[model samples]
Target chain A: MIEIEHVSKNFGKKIVLKDVNATVRAGEIFAIIGPSGSGKSTLLRMINLLETPDGGHITLDGTDIRAGPGLTLDIRRKMAMVFQKPAAFDENVYDNIAIGLRMRHVPETEIKKKISDVLEVIGLSGYEKQRAKTLSGGEMQRVALARAMATDPAVLLMDEPTANLDPVATGAIEELVLRINREFGQTVVISTHDMLQGQRLAHRIGVLMNGIFSQVGTPREVFALPKNKDVARFVGIENIFSGRIARISGGVAEIESDGTVINAVTPLPAGTSVCACIKPEDITLHLVDGSQTSARNVLDGRVARMTAFGSVTRLVVECGIPFSVLITWKSAEEMGIAEGKPVKISFKASAVHVVEDTEVRRP
Target chain B: MGYIIDGLREAFHLIVSLDPDVMEITALSLVVSLTATCVATAIALPVGTAVKFTDFPGKKVLINLIQTLYSLPTVIVGLLVFLLITRHGSLGFTGLLFTPQAMILAQTILILPIMTGLTISALSGVDETIRDTIVSLGATRLQFLTSIVREARFAIFAAVAVGFGRAISEVGAAILVGGNIAHRTRVLTTAISLNTSQWEIGTSIALGILLLAIALVVNTGVSLFQQR
Candidate 1:
């Protein structure tokens, strides 16, 4: 297990990490998600003692890594880090993977066997003799992964490892990382700005904003029920309606604003101002003349704007309140929805998340 | 123009004939420069890498000193070594006043600064990510430095080449310390000077062309290595 206690790092007067405490249990993939400059990379470096946090302690397997200069070397062998870029040595791919093993003075025979195993694991068995610099971006990252894992580190720390690769490479790396986690039982801690990747790979996600971790939980909990407005917006909350609580119906809270009543599943305190949020994909589009749907919230308006995004179309319906709706291209074609066309948008009250408003919750 | 044509003809003839005097001088030049460069590299690489990778007290001063000496005059270095190795000088006990070893010692002084300066530039040119990745892989300090040197191999190669070129081309230091002996210590640069003094244009021009070829080879080899 890796434990960080009250770690704070600073460069000159600018504080990069401020009094952070976190833990990574063995054999779990814990991901840190945040915007740019949120100190996630710096935090990852501290774990390997690369950046050396100006204050606080980082311990790997109950040993303080920053005890002194030589203290980091022995403990760091148990933890290996891969950067956003592969940073492969200008050697052949086989040597690149065998470096950590060679450093540990492993015998030549075992080194060859271990390197071959890692190369096959990362799907680069035939690339052993190729120059590392000649490999593609994705291939280089795979080599970096192989090199780190060749040591059989107890903890593998990655900072945006897939941020530089294409979607196909990203998928491969994600799968390989998952396999490493499952097969080798290596604890993985990765930081990324890609929310989809974070949701897909991470068992638990830590949300960091402005040098502080705002929330740490399962992806479903963090995405569906964010702790605050910042987390909600960062997670791509597209619909935010400013409204005042009007009344509470059974399993529904009605929020009135600008001559429209919005129904939310979660109750809010009465007479309190609140913002209602819903994802664009969550708002369903229906024809103006279609049968009345079972969704709790529906708004009737003309199609204020329509934008096609390859496979899906985004529609902005301007009723008493503006609503953003996502529909498939085939559905949009069937409905004949276009700019200036009339349409009705509907979604369940549960899809409308009452956020940061006491009025939207029950007293 | 007539003298120049005659000189070129005689220079080519001397080169083809494998003149004993000219060959001895060329061989001495190669040996002395190679020795000096090897010694300077032995000291400069670790020192330069340490300077580049770590911050310590008086680092700026040391860097400044190296930069200053990088442009040091060959004659001034000869004068210093002359003063040190002459009788009554500090290291005079070994009687190295007029020997190839003394010449190598002088040239080593001249080349050490260039080697150190170029080494600093080479190691510093290495991408920071290379060092960070090696460190993250749990390499010890010595292993880290070794990896960095390997990553900056081309630059370090250039540094060595420059040092060799500087040492081989130097005339003042070798002439002063080695005394430019007939066959033992007479290098190509000193032979050129002696031939010019004696009006032996054929031998001097031949050795001069040979020296230019060596320098050209060194420069081109370094450039090609860096390109690769």
Candidate 2:
């Protein structure tokens, strides 16, 4: 396991990372999700000692990376990092992939065997003699990945490795990430600006923003329920309506807005201004039939817009306030959902989450 | 037009016949310049790469000054060497003045900046990404630098070609230090100048053709490498 504690970094009087902590278990894929300039890359670089942390220490399996007893190479050799932009050696492809193994003084026969194997794994089998400098951007990136795995590092760190790639290339890299993890059992730490990608690939995800981690959990928890307004909005929570707490009874709080009433399971007191959060996926659409169930909250609205997000479909409903619902394509097809269609959407009062209006959590 | 045609005819004949005087001059030119190029390369590459990559106060100005030396006049270099090698000058007891040794000294000094300056420029063209890749590959410092040298191979090749071109074609410096002595210190450039002064157009034109051919061959080789 790799444990990072209270790490901080600064660049020219600017706080780039503050009090950051992460725990990555062995053989698991961990992702740090953040926007641009959110210090995610800095944290990864510090783990490899490429950038020294200003305040805290990171340890891998009980050895501190900053400890003076061992050469950083001994630590670095166990961890491989693939950069955002691929940098290949000026030699041929064969020699490029052989570099890490050669550094360890691996036997020539073993180096050749390993390089040939990785070249095939990266889908560049026939390119052994081709010049690395002549490869295309995606091909060179694959070679960079191959070189990183040549020595079979115990941990792999990636910083926006697919940020510059086309979708086809991105798909291949995504598959490669899972394959390498399942096959080699290496711990992987990746940072990306794409939340959906982080959700898809990682076992656990951390949301990094403004030099602090606001939330870290399984993708389902972080996506289904955000702890605060900033995270809720940043994570693509579609409906965050301003409301005032009305009254509290039996672990449920009534929230009154401009033209609608809602209830949430919160401990906020009456007369306090708060924001009510709801995920689009949590808003389920019904046929507006007379039949009803135990769901506490329900409303009728005309579909304002319909759009497809890959396999999932999203629709905006013109209730008193606009509410968005994300549903499976099959469900949308069966319900005949389209723009301007009147439909009923409902969610339990427990689905609503409330947070104080004046709170800003920063680490 | 007739005069030019006849000169060309005689130049071709002299080249074909392999005239001993022309051969000696051409051989000496290659030997002296190639020696200087080799010696200059041994010093310039390490020095240039070090001075370029090392961070120190006034580094940019230092690089600018070294590049400025690329324009230093060859005659000024000859004058410096002439003073040092001339009789009654400092360390003049060895009598290298008016010898091939003096000519070689002048040429080495003349091309040092060309080699060093162009080397610095070539290495600076290496993307910052290359350094990060090598260092992250678990390479020792020596391995990192050696790999970079390989990456900058073409640029260094061009620098060597340019340096050798300058050395082989320099007339003023070679004449000043070697005194254009016949069959001994005479090179292609100095011999052409001497023969032209004596109204020996055939010999002068033939030597000029040979020099032009050598430059063409060197440049073509470098071009092939670049294209490849």
Which 10-residue span in candidate 2 chain A carries the lowest summed lDDT? A354-363
Residue-wise C-alpha lDDT for candidate 1, range B47-165, written one tens digit per residue? 89888989899999999999999889998999999999999899999899989999989999898988998999988888777788888887887888898899889889989998998
- Judge candidate 1 at residue A156 and give its lDDT: 92
Candidate RMSDs in order: 3.0, 3.2
Error of 1 at A142 (Å): 0.4
lDDT of 2 by residue, A4-104 (tens): 99999999899999889889999999999988899998998888778888998899989998888366888888888898986687789999888778778
Clashing pairs in 1: A267-A360, A267-A361, A268-A359, A268-A360, A268-A361, A269-A359, A269-A361
Alpha-carbon local distance difference test for all models: 0.87, 0.87
Query: Local error of candidate 1 at B129, Å?
Result: 1.7
Give the winner by DockQ.
1
Could you give candidate 1's per-residue lDDT for residues A1-363 as a string of tens digits?
A: 878888888888988788787888888999999998889999998888878788888888888887777766888888888899867788899999888888889999999999889999999998888989889889999999999999988889999999999999999999999999988888999999987789999988989876677778899988998876677878877677778778886767898877889899765576768788888988888788898899988888889888886588888889878887889988888888789988888888888888655334545
